[model samples]
Target chain A: MDNNSKLTNLHMDAIREVGNIGTGNAATALSRLLGRTVDMDVPVAEFVPIYDVAAHYGSPETYVCAVLVRTEEEFSCSLIFMIEEEKAAILADLIIPMDISGMDEETRLQIRDSALSEQGNIILGAFLNALSQITGWVLPTTTPAVARDMLGSIMDLVASMFGVIGESAMLVKTSLHIKGLDDELGGTVIMIPDPGSLEALLSKLGVL
Target chain B: MTQPIHVGMADLVVSKHPATLVTLGLGSCIGLVIYDQASKTAGMVHIMLPDSREAKNLPKPGKFADTAVPLLLEELAKLGVNKSQLRAKMAGGAQMFSMPGKADSAIFGVGSRNVEATTKLLAASGIRLVASDTGGSKGRSVEFSTETMKFIVKTLGTGTKEL
Candidate 1:
């Protein structure tokens, strides 16, 4: 097989394996938080052209939780989770149950912030670690931005942060089900490769 | 004579005399208003999503369409209003979100799904939909006047129009 085709297959396989591991780690973290056996299932995994991947989910006005992680070699992974507002509140309450009595406005706000941040951290950190183990590359992750009420606004933020990538890139999607919540959370991770970085990673993994 | 009552999301207000119940901003969601003209009683529910199946065990059960509509009807019954005489006018179910290629076919459209679910639920409960303004691409702010039994649908750029 040619070098390009070989690299494609390698990247595809890596993403599939990494998605499973990442979701498993997330399940463990959530189980610890909830003090119960939480079931996390990864239903779908696909490696499609970036544009096709973007088109598949449709741009519904939704609430989004987005985080950006950059590896040691400047390889960036963008994790975006879209959900509805009502679901967001339900998830927030589950993560941080408020006593309601003797709770001030500031405390509520703090609780909300911490819950969102912690949720983002656990999911993203596990995902990055899985990617690192699969590709033998370590990445540093930044804090997540949890937007309460709009999907378009969050996409705009992602576009500005990454600027424009020249052509079609690689995108990975995993549909996750959290057992206790009885709801499915969709996770999309997009990796845009700078030309030099792409070649280096491919070579390091012995695909080039 | 009585003053019109305006009810927003996450609220329930009722009046035994002539009044109005109104709610705004229904996007990919459903707004249900039940009013009995004889008793001048009214209730409005603005549900953001279709059902609470995902949050089945959670409290505050009246936040979903499946649960809220029945709760509203029960409240109306308690106020001495016959279910048959209660007239309903619904508005809202805007496709504020679009999947890229499937714009023409709302096969997976959440807004259309919400409207369908609401209609089906109402029919099963034997509530006749007297008038409705639903399934559009634009968001709507609706007002219900109990005195006149009229539904008003208002868009952001357009002025209020009666349905």
Candidate 2:
């Protein structure tokens, strides 16, 4: 067997295991938040070139909210939720019901705040904690930024911090469907590796 | 008697009597124009995507930048507006990129791509951009006041500016 094929198989196994654990944790957090039995499917993980990820995802107009959590082990994971704007509004309304009839601007403002910051806090924190426990790393929380309406602008900001992931990086796709919400939120976690980081991790896991 | 013609996403509107053109809630989408000062004729398009390639067989060709700009220009010419005297001003391409660690690196940086495509299309049509306000993290509302050939940009959290 070629060394390249062996390495590919090892990376695929690691991603699948990581995705399975992370998704299980995400479902637990969401179920608690919504106070219902939330059924989340296992995540589908893949390693694709950075440039090709957009075309792979169907290029829907996206609204994203994101933050980074750094574990005590000095490793970091980024948690971002991507939803359509209308869906986001719906989720916000679900989290905090407002009187849509004759609501004043101030009330609307509160709804926006609750929807953006508060929702971001709950969802991202839960996802990160779940990811940490699954990966056996303790990740410290950071303040999240809320972005509405435009997918590209938010992406540019993310790119600046993480730099461009090379073609060999992996993109992990996960979907969460919360009961009673009647809508699904999809997320993507990009695993960026430097030099031998992925190989070393795989070797330690006995997957290489 | 001329009323303002406001263009929203995936829309195009035109008037010949110094009509005001407005586009609201512009985040990463582009608002374009072709105005003939000599004839008091103007056209505006609010394009959401950069290319029509992804929209093959789509009903509204005007929703993509590559197809919309030419269509607007052609429509203006049919109304007797000269292509030579046409001047353009654009706004509303915001960074809109998510923070790193949270977003898929592939799909998040499209605002820059949108701006690049819009600029390229307009330039190919021989429409020079007289003024532009783009590439921030906020949404903007753009208004072209044909009364004075002035473009007004109103950004959320920031005050309005005129160019």
Candidate 3:
């Protein structure tokens, strides 16, 4: 293989390691927040064409609850925590632990939705914290932007925002499930490192 | 039976009524839709950048406003769309992230830049921009119907709106 190809592989590997560490920390945070242990599948990280990210998790049209954090650095990146909307409602039930039988529609929505939004922030913040520790990089992230929307639209914004650097995105991904909860209640976490950061990140990883 | 032509990122297409044209998920990128109501010919370009010069003069005209606008107008002309009859509608120029204390930084300003470029080019091409749903912190799905000349924008929290 060419030296460039070899280096690309190393970069991808370093990002996968980032996912493992970041997601592990995120899982711990979720466990503490929900008062239930959280576990994750192996994290997957790679460079993907802008169009393919939505398909990475499932259908593009899947209704997802997301917390989006835009990281600003010389090597910038965006981190996202997502769960299916219905599953997020279930998680909200856990966070609020209240009956909605007598609540008004607006009140019910406010309670459940806010819980999910807070969860998104907590999990993503944990991931970022872990990333900063390992890379020794001061990664400043944006205020969490929360959404319950089609996955495609969210991914699109990520692509356009990062496309300032290039067409392809480097994604570090991991899947999460709450311990003792049905596996179906779980969701995915993703990170897209800016194209400009690729070289610096690769070099920091250093031929490993 | 008819199907809407789908335009992906950095792509463009032209179509007629009873057939729709669509592009999904426009963040900082602009979806420039133009049509001649009289001739019923419409075109859409999913442009990712403001200037062709930024792309190092690559041949992907549809990828930049400076290049895409002229090329799209040329394609529409080939379809018999009169230059004087063309009008424009645009959507999807959202700044997805906010920068801290550096509001004027170009780092996250692609969305605003895209909107500005599209507007400028439409004017220079002599096409009047009749409507636009642009700017803000949200992404949008856009569909243009050549029949009624409606630009439909769909967002997550705001529901669907027509311009």
Candidate 4:
């Protein structure tokens, strides 16, 4: 490999390490929230063409629920927590003591919305906390926003918001699985540093 | 043979009869289509931004509304399509996420601005926009068939519609 390729590999490794730490913390938070053991896969970090983000997860038309939270001021990044809509309902049922199926439609929706939002907030908070500890950077995140839609549609917004600065995006991803549950209960978390923020992040880590 | 052409984000494609140009999962992004019925030719661009002024001078003209519209027309012109003979149909540009009390800000208005830019440019170019399914809180996938001259849109939980 050339020097550039070698440097890219090192950078990717550093990013993956960051993801591992962040997701590990996030999995712990989920485990506490659900009272179930949460297992996390080793994180992956790489640069991807912005256009291919949706297809990277699955078919672009796949219906999914996503919660996006962004860090404002100082170091910037957007973190998206996504799971199948059906799976998110399962998650909500697991958290809410009452059986959601017994409730009216509006009440069930309210409960589900609050449950999912809180889970998103906690998971993202834990991940950001880990990163702040490592980089000593203040990462105040925006209120988490949730959207349920096709993967492609959600990613289109993400790509547009991030694609303003470059043709490619750096994505750090990890999969979280609740122990004893089927794989369908798992969800993925993706962290994308805002354009120009990756360099600052790497510098903070002494990896650049 | 009927073929399907896939248009990715910030990309554009043009095809003649017996082809369907499809772009999937558009949220806050406009899928701009220009077609000539007589020639059975159509071009579609998945536009991400409203303008290209802020982007570096690269050749990816389909990434922004200001650039993609003219670029699509130029490509169609090469296919023997006259600007005056073209009609437009578009879908997408939906605000996919809204936070409480933040819906009125510019950050949440990208979808509308994208729709506005494309419409203004199309009007200036004299292309009559005959059909559209443009704003809402949902994401849309669109398929434009050159053979049938139909713009079919699909969204989650919602049935398909022909615009």
Candidate 5:
């Protein structure tokens, strides 16, 4: 993790700029899809422990609707779009193609998960598309999959990527803001780039 | 009420009768539980990787299966539980996600590798692995009861099962 801490405020600011542009595009697509204006916070780039990443939102066992996306081409990085269960269900109610209100609990859960995965594709896809333009790298987005489970379980599945690289993650935190519509309705887009990729990105941005 | 002692990632804890030892979030990490029926004592270690040799930094025993197993067993031995009487029940080491094209052979295969190293080390230490539920695509939370020496595995959606 010592290597991970080498990113100074200047380096973090530079990475945050890239995240801003990428998530900015995602926010635009989300607005278009929801027919409402959505704003995004300035992304905060930092190194974080994989064990406690979920603690930022809540507990490790807290139910989350997560879209796990990883890209190996043009530099390896994994991105996660995660929302708390009830918050994700609220977004699902708005975006899901089916009627969720009249359905029973189990049926509504299925609809919610299906809707959120597509939402992951749209939002995360737009982020990757914009990042491609910025980096001048054709970074093909990975297939997005939704898993409605404990955040720890999802992290466990992907912990090896970090284990083989560094115990710390290059966590890029982006928050969405819907204001009065739903103050807590936004999601977090977390990016954990491998050490090599982090070096490449930082150097490319003249931060190194 | 006796509280469950919580073990964090790359850490371990030991407890006595009526006390519970738990570790949260066993994603690709492992929770190795060792218990002594006579002493009614339990010890749990949360291991993250397979071998200490793989790590370049200062060795944190609990961070690797190779080092954690022996060290934790030593901790139990100092607590008056004979090494010969220790029985192990391990869980976690689940691959929570898969790579795109690398689904067939996931990168590093850390889950099974952790289990492999733990099994090898435990066998060498002369401890029998009584029961385990490991190697899947789900993260598990585990709790060990000193009273019954029962290992409980909890997945996100599937509820809880005894190991």
Candidate 6:
């Protein structure tokens, strides 16, 4: 966003702290759902060119299951929860205790989709709630939408929203890791505040 | 020793024979390619939105359908490629996220709108649209080679297609 030059090191540190607190709350909510310990990595808050956002996350062409939720009205931001497609199946298994090995393929797939969507709703809700409590800004999010596609496509679509007004995006990313799992089924949460919202956010923090 | 020039979102590039132009992960965005077969000169643009007039800022020309088409033509013109001989092919503009009952949302159905705007622009510019793949709920990655005049479209879970 254009306000990048206006943001100082203090503003960035405050944003990172906000990310840490929000994601820390989300980790607790996720752990409650999966009945396992969930650990969060230190959040990364940086400004990345719109063109390189996908590459910064990972290989652009790799397939990922993503859940997207956009803030309504005031904040004008979005949150994308991304996990590997293969890992999504494991995520569904942990959330739903019923044995689906005997069910038909279609039914199993439907259940899996529902499980994933519910997981997204819970995690994103927790994160937003924490942000709202901290910022005292009414940040209501839209219904979550899920898609499994190439990360490049997903990220570029999001980047385009930022590109409309600016050349780069300020991304706050936090990775969630499930404890005691040989293969991690955790996902990454990316928060993108829209062009004007960043300035508004910083002003709310009295940093602008 | 040909290298493929990568086009990012809201970006455009022009190249000559043996040089491939590629754009990845297009969702609600159009990837338009215009090429002159004789000179083997080609231009590719990743258009994010449909119109520039509605944008708040003076966005890059490559970011909108209305502006990108003309800019692509002008770029090709600089390479000594005639507009009369230019043929167009495109892929992408897919609705990545489905928002139920939120038709008024800004991004809702943007894929089809982008496709419509690009099609109208190409027709108005007198460039023949040879082929296209648009209006789906899936994202696409496209590659165009000026040498072979081949446009390859790839998607996850679905096999690749040559347009």
Among these predicted structures, which one has the highest DockQ?
4
Candidate 4 lDDT tens digits, B1-163: 3668899888889987878899988998999899999999999999988877776554578888998998999999999987789999999989988877667545567888899999999999999999999989999989998878999999888889998
What docking tier does model 6 reach? medium
Give lDDT: candidate 3, residue B139. Answer: 75
- Model 4 clash pairs are none
Cα DockQ of the candidate 1 complex: 0.02
Can you list each candidate's DockQ? 0.02, 0.09, 0.35, 0.69, 0.55, 0.57
Every model's TM-score on chain B: 0.85, 0.91, 0.94, 0.95, 0.93, 0.95
Fraction of the reference Cα-Cα interface contacts (below 8 Å) that each candidate reproduces: 0.00, 0.10, 0.28, 0.67, 0.52, 0.57
Highest-scoring model, TM-score: 4
Q: What is the C-alpha lDDT of each candidate?
A: 0.56, 0.60, 0.77, 0.86, 0.78, 0.85
Ranking according to DockQ, highest score first: 4, 6, 5, 3, 2, 1
TM-score of 3: 0.86
Q: Can you write out model 5's per-residue Cα lDDT over A18-135, one digit (the tens) per residue?
A: 8898899998988888888888988988766755655655778877778877777886777788888778888877877666688798987877777887788888888888888878
Provide interface RMSD per model, one decimal: 14.2, 9.3, 3.3, 1.5, 2.6, 2.1
Q: How much is the lDDT of residue B66 in candidate 4?
A: 91
Sort by lDDT, top down from the best: 4, 6, 5, 3, 2, 1
Query: Which prediction has the highest lDDT against the true structure?
Result: 4
**Chain A of candidate 4: what's the TM-score?**
0.93
Docking class of 4: medium
Q: Model 5 TM-score?
A: 0.91
Q: lDDT (0-100) at residue B52 of candidate 1?
A: 57
Docking verdict class for candidate 1: incorrect
In order of appearance, the predictions have TM-scores of: 0.45, 0.53, 0.86, 0.93, 0.91, 0.92
Docking class of 5: medium
Name the lDDT value of residue A17 in candidate 6: 85
